[model samples]
Target: MSTDPTRETPHDLEAVDRDDAYAQLVARYSAPERVAVALDKVKAEARRRAKARQLVTRARGGLLHNHTVREIARYFRKAERGRVDLLQVSEGTGIPLTDSRQVLREFVDAGLLYEYAEPVGKEVRRSYALAEGGKGGITEVFIETEAASRLEEQENRARGTLGWGEA
Candidate 1:
């Protein structure tokens, strides 16, 4: 035999073919149920997180609305003896007159604000002020309490969903 090693080898090609076949067989028989279950769990967790975020946003909105209403009521209670019109309240609170009117209307409906209507064409303008019970009005307390309750409920739900205390 000639002493030469620069020749094509059949065993090298056969080994590569065997490796490919083994990989294909492993892929074809793999079980995917575990991956599917994990994916489902991830999706469910995402949905729960989204709902918790929505609750937080709603709670914050209620808190802000209650705080603003309280501020407006406090402003009126501290004003001079004379009545303050909606425009004056709006100017003092740095809120638009239209928004102030809306808040006034809500407070009036809720019995937290009292409205005084002057005679038509009278030089004196109509005005609004805190109701008879002043800052301790039932409506004001109700709004504040409701906001607080909602915030607490949201926090509890978030904590429970995130498994904060669960073993």
Candidate 2:
């Protein structure tokens, strides 16, 4: 029974101490039988890296640093409304898809990247390009348009209907 007199309740009998319950959970998952879960994660990451390397090899490009924002900017140097899918960026840059997406997002926020939706068939596909002024002078209209495009792309992504194209 709980020590509090006013809190009389039948469910109180089933309540376990928080610390004790946490320790039990830790012990349960730490058992040898559960160690495969950890190993499986490592193996999965290895497979992803191997696939990324294969893609880099197929693209005939050197692997860039994992998280270089400058490299991404440089990739868009000659782009004026250049159309590129997210998977192409991932393969060309040799960065993981999630990381490349994040860096692109940061570039978008910094006005170095211009994101827009290109109509592909019946659905709109997202793409990015370098701002016209070379990141020195981004117009207010460009910023607003890019911001709206990014928001709409995010919504499409969440809905899982927007295809990023061959990865």
Candidate 3:
């Protein structure tokens, strides 16, 4: 029984009214045990749906965010190993320097990148390389390749599902 008519199907509203009437009648004449069981069923169904929705959301977020981070880290590692500077990374990746720096920082924070200081005459210059456990210094290139491959696979699956061809 929603106040918004558009939200309440005719059948749904009828069911709600019928349920309300039954509840009033039960309170007046039915055994307390029957009412308690009915309420418990409703509560259990609501809990189940809520849990399902939460699980879906958590799964989606984990896939999207974790994949993005891993892919970005792989890109940075490849660029560093190739002797590409930050400017080159910005241009080649088509990500602005600021955003690229942020992504790189995350990899550093995650311990996927090793940071070191190269001493200059007056100031120290910081540089990065792949951490010992990572795929050496070629992580970025590998990640980019892997991501492209995955995307292609996804596209092919989608086309197959929809009866479409490569466009």
TM for every model, in the order presented, reads 0.40, 0.35, 0.35
lDDT of 3 by residue, 82-135 (tens): 334455556666667676666555555544556666777897655666654444
On the 0 to 100 scale, the lDDT of residue 76 in model 1 is: 59
Candidate ranking under TM-score, highest first, comes to 1, 3, 2
**RMSD over all Cα atoms, model 2:** 19.0
Question: For candidate 2, which ten residues in a row score worst on lDDT?
Answer: 58-67
lDDT of each: 0.58, 0.54, 0.54
Q: Report the Cα lDDT for residue 75, model 1.
A: 67
Alpha-carbon runs more than 4 Å astray in model 2? 1-66, 78-81, 118-124, 135-167
Model 3 misplaced regions, further than 4 Å: 1-71, 76-84, 117-125, 136-167
Candidate number that wins on lDDT, 2 or 3: 2
Pairs of colliding residues, candidate 1 = none
Model 1: weakest 10-residue lDDT segment is: 50-59
lDDT of 2: 0.54
Clashing pairs in 2: none
Q: Can you give the lDDT of residue 50 in candidate 1? A: 46
The TM-score of predicted model 3 comes to 0.35
Model 1 TM-score, all chains together: 0.40
